[model samples]
Target: MISSNMNVTFENLSDITDDLVIGDQVFTSRLMLGTGKYRNLGVAKQSIECSQTSIITVAIRRLQSSSNFQPNNLLNMLDWKSIWLLPNTAGCTTAEDAIKIATLGHEICKKMGQEYNSFVKLEVIPDSKYLLPDPIGTLKAAEYLISKNYTVLPYIYPDPMLAKQLEELGCATVMPLGSPIGSGQGLQNLENIQIIIENASVPVVVDAGIGTASDAVKAMEIGASAVLVNSAIAQAKFPQLMAKAINLGVHAGRYAYLAERMKKLSRAMPSSPSIGFPN
Candidate 1:
């Protein structure tokens, strides 16, 4: 009973919808992978490929320090042409250090033939125990980076006010953590994250603390534009399989969101109409 026009429309749906735009870049995939904590460079490369992520975050400090000594380096392993680099300032504590690391990441991206890419995942995490990002330092770093024309995606706690402030400051995206970094605790601050998503003008990325495919699904279902997962994928028994599973979950969640889920009622309702049925 399907019409030709409806079939055509259904076929061309992908061409019209679900493009994630961050500043000057347009990405199809909502899942962003971090290139750290993998067992090896090969595993990381495979996971990246399996996840089908358009963007991959590289720790600039880690790459710089390990590239010289390590035979199999991350820079050489990844196919730079297809994958866009989102250089992250992970080890930096202060704004100054983060700025410096971000600058280095920019140069490294240029060297990798991504000359136009000025994307930086700004992280000014002064706290050592929880590995939480410092809001004040992140704000300072984001301001400076924005001034310098770098596309800043700052990782911060799930604070709605702070997310709005960053969006006002011309940040490309506000990446609020679901929980403590590498904790695999999932979305601990769901209410705050929802508030951030509701108020944010820019893309709200749920970064850090994702444990499994369900975590990614929860994040996406709750209206997060994207999710950046690292430890969960890297530390898994099968990184490639986990990556594939998580990618599918991300797609499922996104589609479910776009489909406009049915509203929840206070009381249960029967599927069959009561008046229509004859006893």
Candidate 2:
């Protein structure tokens, strides 16, 4: 269980004054990890611990089909008290399929003793090649899920209009993809993502396509509330090390954002005053 003691201490970094508020819950860590694509469950567990992430997203469909759904399964191994389970509707193509998967996700949460946890990472991706989410399907599914009292965090393309629509529809957060899922292309839609962040009242979580620690840093520096990383860490030669790197990047980016940045200039200027210098 995540207690006050488990909260990561940011020494010398006192600028961060607020916690990441999603729905009725508050998370100290802004780096959310995904429990997938790992060499083994042990690696996944170690990576989660190394990342210092309080929230972990699990693909409900994948979990259901896995042979490890026994008494000593992945669910049983996790320290659920401290970790927040974000069951995602992955592998669902249509609104109806997503809704069903979401329902199942809720059940999975309940089984894990989170009866009041209604959070679902909503994804409706029909494009197999790109793995891009379907805007229409996402909206429809989000509406239905919200009506059912689910705290939906919809994954979507970096479309400001669509993001606003989802936010207005009672979504807990608008998760705009930085790029294609598992592509590791980094933030390809910076402008649109910035627009979404600027116009959004809810938190904007940049999901997917985070290749390096720098990618995660850039996302947070640009005012993203959080980021969801999966393949970047899992596919790396050293998953645990990558997790630590990503965690540090998140903190650095958030600190930079809070500290604010210097303005840009078209031309170079002298560092020292010309009048003070000896002629």
Computed on alpha carbons, the lDDT of every model, listed in order, comes to 0.89, 0.91
In the predicted model 2, the residue pairs found to clash are 1-81, 1-82, 2-82
Model 1 lDDT, full chain set: 0.89
The C-alpha TM-scores of every prediction are 0.92, 0.92
Q: How big is the positional error of residue 90 in model 2, measured in Å on the Cα after superposition?
A: 0.2
lDDT of 1 at 79: 80
Per-residue lDDT tens digits for candidate 2, residues 195-260, read: 999999898999999998999999999989999999999999999999999999998998788667
lDDT of 1 by residue, 2-80 (tens): 1111222456666535778899898878999997789987898899999999999988887676444354677777788
| Candidate number of the best lDDT | 2
- What TM-score does candidate 2 reach? 0.92
Which 10-residue window of candidate 2 scores lowest in summed lDDT? 1-10
